[model samples]
Target: MNHFLALTRRGAIALAFALTLPLPAVAATKIQHLISPGGIEAWFVQDSTVPLIAMEYAFGGGATQDPPDKPGVGNMVASTIDEGSGDLDSKAFHERLDRRAIELSFSITRDYFRGSLRMLKDNKDEAFDLLHMALTSSHLASSDVERIRSQIMSGLRRDTTNPNALASRKFLELEFANHAYSRPASGTLESVPTITVADMRDYISRVIAKDTLKIAVVGDVDPATLGQLLDKTFGSLPAKAKLTPTPDVVATAPPQRAFVPLDVPQTTITFGAPGVMRHDPKFMAAYIDNHILGGGGLSSRLYHEVREKRGLAYSMFEALLWMDHSSLVVGNTGTRADRAGESIDAIDKEVRKFAQEGPTQQELDEAKSYLKGSQMLQLDTSSKLATAMLQYQLDKLPIDYLERRSGIIDAVTLDDARQMAKRLWGQGLVTVVVGREPQAAAEAARAPGAPPPPKAN
Candidate 1:
């Protein structure tokens, strides 16, 4: 009620700042592990200070699990689940959520189906019960299905003309050919119309189950109560998820140039090659290396060279994007159509420079300092902590990841940074430019139709 609450005798602690307020702690956040009798496991952060709770969960199957025939079924399922469930119709369910100030939502990512719930502590039971209904007994109403389909199709069609969208879609097409990664997470115009209500039901039956679920809960809750709640919310699901087996692969785009020519003032470019996986032993080094290379905004090599120095593009950046099956050092920039060639050359110059020399001692030091300081901001909020806790589990990080993370980053030596730089950027970049073709591409296109000069002796 006042200052401290001994959550349990097992070092499970909570700082009860006020009756229902959570205060930021300068110490490491403590995580409690809970396993339900039904075999459901979840990570809990007990924070009774705030009369609030946040829950984030994900299943291994995301949009990638959509049938090759129907690209958006997973998305459709996410959209429809909260619309109506069991005895409550769409309007009734949503009205209840609104009246109670309970926030409930879902998303379909490339590799996971995610859900988030937030509610006042007093409304926890009703909020979770409603969530259980949506997950277990969604009605998949027909009218809702058609309306959502048309909405998605309209967006997909617009993507064809959106320059940034064109570049991003093309990059994926080249990066993950013949793989589920290549398929549109949001169904294509051709696929969404074919997605039926029955298809939504089937998607749920196959992917939403206890085996694939990972959860993180924070706020006025104890482990024992959470254990009971976890069982009640998830226990009824099937023991296993009948997910499609996705094969392992790497980002396949080589050091080559691909373009989607469009009539626009600016060319939007998305480019990169393979990157280290999240769980790789060298990821910490790579993370620091990347920060110096392109992850530091204007302080990054790519930004300083491409934007700050030469002004070739408005902005540029590169990042390590890790998926369940593949990893990549992806990046993007935008420039005037006519000057796209200049930006490409500048980006390549910086990448090759960093790959060869890595970060200087000074650069490495600064990067490490910034990265370490910035990390605290990421875990500062209860909602963010829940989301991060879920991600650490997904990334296969140990329970003490937050406590040990700073040391991991600080331990990277200059040699470590250099070696990681070479490993991540040595191959150079594979780029996709959307809008007018760069100069090289424009010249290459002329060869197919134009007459060639006589061969040199």
Candidate 2:
């Protein structure tokens, strides 16, 4: 077919639904589980809405899978995987996607290399074909390698002077110590240049295998066909992922004041303590306590104590960050250099208070209500729904997690919340401060930019 006719034919397949019309939302309470004929397992939610299909899958290797000498290899592969594949060269591959309105992309985090693909129902075949090529026979072209490497290098250079990047890196350094978590997810100034195309290929070969893969799918497909697509997209790979086993480690950031001196108008303070594991029975209680303490944004105790009551920092909040190796309750705030000591003192007082008393009954009730109501937003679209399903799989939660999520939250009694509060904040904080030396001894402690992509942490 001529180019225009090919485009016309491709577009015509979904034109009956006009390509832009949204199919009705599928009731998604029940997650359908299936094992492909090839024995590949995936979680599915059959939504024919909008003539669209979205698949999100992850391999257990990410930056952590990078060779010790090559910190950003996985990230570079994520950038180049679609640059060329099999018979299609870089430009040709992208053109096919654009012409058919298919979306396929990859990203790497600290723990997993993840990919997403979306397509009109009429184009699922081509979509899976392109994905298969990406997984199985990506060119990882030398020219593309240099191009992507330069981009990563540029970001690393900028991170050297970027205050937030500097602070985040330092925080991770303190938290993870010698673990892979201590390294930046993308690479450092010295690491990116040394990551060769061969290293990228080695990572791809060893990590993108069935034993380490997790998948979730939404929109316009049935199990049997999805099984075939899964086999086509992933079946040819080696069944076992040859990942270097990551060791178990805890964040070892000690309680004390530390600083990365930088000349800037305001100082940033970061603080954290050990966190409970996701699998721990007390996790839901702790999760709620975290929200009530600092994860609730302006509504949180940290916000009220530091920002509203004292006007110490423009922003302050904490979150429970979970990684394969370590868990932490990390928070950051920015304020005038002179106010740094006061801000730290304020935070310390609040932590002490919360550890002793936990959240008020009214606060717990409100937080639960908001969290329950917000679950709808999590499933508002096919892509997000697929991602949520993927997370459930990653977390090893049961397939009925969505149904049980509310009950889990509701089960956290006043005593549980109080116990969690005491448990989470009862330790000395590991604190890092930047922008200026913290003004006093009592103290301790502690993006956006058109500047560059964020350095991985």
Candidate 3:
């Protein structure tokens, strides 16, 4: 039997067992705060149900740390870091991983450079050693860098015609104008080519350090053993990161509609307005309010109005997006090119009404109940739990946040939810629609005395 398959089977069995536990038992998961001898720290959840370990970690200064002209450096580093490290060439490094059934990967969001590792507990020593090498001694060789660059460039080319990508990119460009947040994390076609091996190495040195690190581990490991592994894996990094100070910014775009013309049959729409930050006292209220509005899936008001009532689109959604430095209530949907304007109108009307009237007492109660119960879905697996714990750490939430989460949601009264709705959505949305010009605009242009249609960008 394949070791990898065996491990996966055992993991599934463990997950099934975990799912059978009461929600309170899962929520009361004991989180041990551990500090290694070398001063490295991690949040650990000891689960001996399966002989596997999953680690998730992040460092501050993600794509925002890239040079303005070479915006993809952080992304490139993330893609190439695990290709080779220490004395191992690319092939040798991967072969070692394959032999041990270890899984290691890296990614970059606008605010964080993240990594994850999963392996059998029996191979913990080698797994941690490989992780340390990838962090401290990644060999971003010329050949590997060029190959990855080509891949990124190809993807960028494809994104040009992808309506969803176009709408999202244009929305960010318009909303965050002149701010670092506007730049694409994957680097643009022009920027990716300009990135060099030196840039990748420099980014790793400046951004990956103990000072900005947050880690979460879930597995069959004790605090003492985890403490030692933490030091051994991360202690060699620099004490502090040399991240450039990124300024706080809100959505600067005017509350108006922008259009990107593509030949796609279905128009993709992206819209947003300023929102509350993560640590704000009102965030929990905003969370419940958004759930009632659009974040609650099929039960949401947006879905019912846009899809069920109007039949304008198959689905629609909105959520509160809180970045490290900025926040927004963002939403998206798709519709036939000819019906795009109507769909937008329907969505906007609902949003404006919600902002004015807020949720009813019944809506508020149901939203609170659904949000409270959904916490279990986030903790059903070790990897998922690790990822969620890491995010809580990033958000500066307390370790007991899981236990306290339900109470927080329950405390948001109808009055509080109503207030939060007005605060979050009252400002209106700046919308981006990517497809052919809406039929309404086209008809207006063709009317007897109408001005000529505006040329596409």
Candidate 4:
């Protein structure tokens, strides 16, 4: 055990050093497309500078694949998939990973179930074998399932009182309404307890298949050897995923707002509007425009207006969200209960003005420069580079996208930014506030009869 701890320490030190070293330009990184003898495919970036390997992979069916009644089946599977597999129990399985300093984790978003692995080159064989077992033969024992389910329920219970979580949940529920996208990625307290081991196994059988797989690997591995590893690790998965066809959705354009009342000291606000899809011609333009509006940290217009000028909130931000089935421009901020209405009004005015007039020439130039320069940060480490590569694959971008990305950003002219801004954010926002009722709404409620204020959850 001491030797294992020492090796883990050494591995952490090596990773820290690797993170400090300068990374090659993404365009020059030379992503190699590889196909295994068994026809499994992966994107590989060979780097011998560090004696470590990082792998990131995703499958198409994410939380959306969960049965309508079982909203968190996919999330539960992600939690328990690595607990044990094959002949190993949870303790024995984790012991093997700890001995080798292998890092394995799984996560799921609305559209994809994702997993990552990091291990020293010398331990690659054991690492891949364990990963293979986890994916192909996860042992979702009843005890393990209940343990993870308890953990999930604990989180869900906490979220019930969490102002931010409540606001986000309310916003999605109001926006998506009847759509599965409205379901929380983490299963709710009620739904999580009812999920059985059989349900988890069924989720894996339907979702973890070769046809939906996207893999990206980085570090000291050659194409031929990586191909062999790919086949050995993933080739056994079902040839095709039995995914339910999810229809594309556009965010509700009719302005909608809802409030979930909690006794917190501050109100957390989440707002959203329709946004351009990833493949839209104006996406790049809208991306830059969003940065100027709220995506840029303290330099953003929203931050300047809300925090710097009026002191309504400590921080504010807006971002473009492109999901597999829908797209949205979402923003969030928190402020004192009494000032929540002021914060909302400030944000609305800024958004409307920006949509009509767009970013200034200086703002546009600065945004473009920052976007280009910050690209390197995303690839500075092996794990980060692998994750970025996986996203590129998921987006269906060309192999040479990094090389042409700057050119694409540069092509967005002032006119494009203005047009995209109006098109993306001009529709107005669907807002959700959680905490004390806003001052204006409270006053109106006290007056005549303002529909008796929406019931608090």
TM-score, every prediction: 0.90, 0.89, 0.91, 0.92
lDDT of each: 0.79, 0.80, 0.83, 0.83
lDDT of 2: 0.80
The residue-by-residue lDDT of candidate 1 on 1-457, one tens digit each, is: 0001112111111312221243476126588787877778988888865777888898888887899988989988887788889899988988888777677888888778888887778888888999999999988888777777777788888998998888878888888888998888888888888888888888899899888899988888777777888888998988899999998788874687788988765778899887778878888898888778887887988888888777778777778788888888888888866678778888888889888998899999999899989887767667768878888887888878888988998899999989988887788888998886556445543667755422211
Best candidate per TM-score, number? Answer: 4
- For residues 1-457, write the lDDT of model 3, one tens digit per residue: 0000112111233334543443333335888788888888888888877677888999999889999888899999988998899999889988888777777788888889988888878889898999999999888999999988998899999999998899889988887887888999899998999898888888998999999999999887888888889999998899999999999998764477898988766789998888788999978999888888988888999999998888888558887877888877778898766678888999899999999999999999998888888888758778778888888898999998888899998888888988988887887889999988666545654679855543211
Off by over 4 Å in 2: 1-27, 438-457
Models ranked on TM-score: 4, 3, 1, 2
- RMSD (CA, angstroms), candidate 3: 6.4
Report the C-alpha displacement of residue 322, candidate 3, in angstroms: 1.0
CA displacement after TM-score superposition, residue 446 of candidate 3 (Å): 15
User: Quick one: best lDDT, which candidate?
Assistant: 4
- Model 1 residue runs over 4 Å out of place are 1-23, 437-457
- Over 227-289, each residue of candidate 2 has an lDDT whose tens digit, in order, gives 999999899988999999899787774476578988765778898887876778888888889
Scanning candidate 4 in windows of ten residues, the lowest lDDT window is 1-10
Per-residue C-alpha lDDT of model 4 across residues 269-306, encoded as one tens digit per residue: 99978777788888899899989999999899999998
